[model samples]
Target: MSLVMQENLEGKAEIPRIINDGKESVEDIISNRKQISEKQDELEEVDRELRDISNELKSYDLPEDVDVSSLESQRSEIEGRISEMRQEIGRVEHEIETLDEKVDEIDEKWREEAAKESKHRTMMRKLDFVEDAHEELTEIKQTILAQIRENTEENMNRYFNDLIWKDEDYTVELGEDYTVSVYGRHGDNKIGSLSAGEKQVLALSFMSALTKISGFNAPIVIDTPLGRISSKPKKRIAQNLPDYLMDTQITFLMTDEEYTDEVRAHLQNSVANEYLLDYSNEVTEVKGR
Candidate 1:
């Protein structure tokens, strides 16, 4: 039974392929990641604000002397507006989370079928009539599995190394589960774990790496990445981001406090565009200044 399963898996799986066009420009890669992260963050802020507005309508109360009917009508209108915003926000958020899932699906199908073709390459090498197709199938599956493992390892390592944890870059595990295990630095380990900030960075970093390695084009986006960090680290992030992520276009969505002039100057040369979003009566608008 195990052999049969292995045969089927190999017969339907795909082999590994890596880029040979030379290493990608680190600058372009990081810039793209930043663009995507910023856009996603913008949508998230809008979604949260809409939720708060919806809750405000639900909690509205008027004085006894006020026109109850008119007040109720106003509240209802606000509620309807929030509902509309929620629908739009939901759609946008879904697209962000699944960003390149469709691409993955398409590539996965191709890889599975390519595994079968690889066997033909081997069979042609051997002059013997390959009647034992199962032998070939098993080999293909192993090859495909090995490829997947290698890709995941490389993808996890690059970003995990950038983590600011005290531990020596060992908290990351990309073998079985997409889980990050933070361990103590060369001492007694108290259950390994990734902090919220570390996990966020790892996820963002992996997303960027996967897109680049998979040969798919995507704009990098990072929203409120410093939400978990202090002003000091945030400043450090602003100063060195472009150095690590050179040419990648990035969009950084941030609060005013997080987007101070000092921070802006640090990233000015790296940032292609800067935007300002301000709240207005019954409407919020995007402005580029």
Candidate 2:
């Protein structure tokens, strides 16, 4: 599998290797990491055993009547045992610390891998969406083209009716531009040639048409929806938005000016829910597992 990178170079695709060593590599790393963790746990067990032995040694009140040398020898044996236990405990703790560091490193690597996987998944999902859109466009190719033709004609008549133009034809081109290319009667130019404001109108019109046709009754989340429009065009959008998004679920993410009280009041009639995120004074708690 390949990680999805937005900056896909000219030669970036990796050839599918017949013999995959990735699984083996992953197994090795996982095995090593697991071994370290297990060893650390075992070390903790040994430390507890040593502590118990030390406590037992202290609990035994040696008899005063016993031979001094014999008592010394017995105490020495216990001391030796305690010493060995302490050494073992130290060794286990060192190994545990080492394993802890190694586990941390493993986690860091997994984090990087997860991020790459997420990006790859996101890229694949996007491709799937585009392919679906393309398929949808393919299925309704003629219908959408006709709609575009009709809508474009209406917009041109309303906006550029008095302007001098060239080709006066607005025939819908089927599958030619994926329903995006608009051959203006002014010069038969593509929609790409349209002015900024015109492009905004076209985009809004296209979105309205798309959502209306798709029939997905979901909230519309708009981030800076009016970034590309002027006051006049924004007002026009405010007035004309209802024509397209009549009863459809919609959400608009906006800033102060974009979500002004007037704008909110205007959209409130169209939208049933609204929220404002003000981080001026907020607090959050963080904890670790």
Candidate 3:
């Protein structure tokens, strides 16, 4: 029993050492476990960071054969082109401003030209109106003159045929210049060949026609009407004159040589009254006959 006690005391002493040593070993094991847990947490963080980097790389989706250096070169070239484009835009804007100024100038010029054109158009319209009016007046004048000429021709022919003692048929034509042309048989002009008496008869006929067509009611007076005519033409004229101018008032002042017995006999039937003018002692006196 005493040996067993001694052995137990020794065992107890040895047990404390052993337990202390075991405590040291357990502390080491616990420290090593803490270090291992820290390493695992760090590994997990690294894995998460690697996954994020892989997802970023996948989003880029770069082809396997693409060169990073070439992409960088292309980026520099694109930047250079963008700089050139900006300069070109500035130049274009300046040109646009210049063109705007030119357009404004052109617009002002066009406005002035348009005003002139408007005035020209107004003048042209007035010219057209004047031309039309002139044409209308000319036409009316021509028509009136034509009517006057035709009436004068008819009356002259009637009076001439009545008084003329010629056996041939004669035609009297009034030229546009108011010259008298007498045509005889075979269309020959007889004015140059007519005797003084015949010409006087033609002049009397023309005068009578003109007076009738003059549209005046004034009395006609004549002196020496048949002075150049022969006795036969004078008698014939006196016979036809009163009848042709039946509606007109006419007076004849004649000398005794012109107022022959034969002319008086033909005109006395148509005379309503007679007057004589006598010039003696440089004074004129009118006496009723």
lDDT of 1: 0.59
Candidate 2 regions with alpha-carbon error over 4 angstroms:
1-179, 195-197, 281-289
Could you give candidate 2's per-residue lDDT for residues 1-289 as a string of tens digits? 3434442321122211201234444455566556656755665665676566557657877577746576456556656665665666566556656656665665665566555656666787897899899988897987877676565545444333222123354432324454555665564756566667666566666566556656676666656776665554465566567656777666665667666556656665566555556554475333221
Cα lDDT tens digits for candidate 1, 1-289: 4444455456544333211111222333344456556655665665676567557657877457767677556656656655665665565556544544544554565565566556655554453345356678889988876676567667666555654543465544454544544345564433335566666666655665556556544567778866766565555667655555555667788888788787888888887777788888978888888
In order, candidate lDDTs are 0.59, 0.57, 0.74
Worst 10 residues of 3 by lDDT: 1-10
TM per prediction = 0.44, 0.37, 0.59
Q: Which 10-residue window in model 1 sums to the lowest lDDT?
A: 16-25
Estimate, for each residue in 115-212, the C-alpha lDDT of model 3 and write its tens digit.
55555556666767988999999999999988888889889988888888888889899987778889988999999999887887888889888888
Q: Which candidate comes out best when scored by TM-score?
A: 3
Name the candidate, 2 or 3, with the larger lDDT value: 3
Query: CA shift at 163, candidate 3, in angstroms?
Result: 0.8
After superposition, which runs of candidate 1 have C-alpha atoms over 4 Å from their true positions? 1-148, 163-171, 187-193, 239-247
Relative to the true structure, candidate 3 reaches a TM of 0.59
Those runs of model 3 whose alpha carbons end farther than 4 Å from true positions after fitting are: 1-101, 246-249, 265-273
Q: What is the lDDT of residue 253 in candidate 2?
A: 59
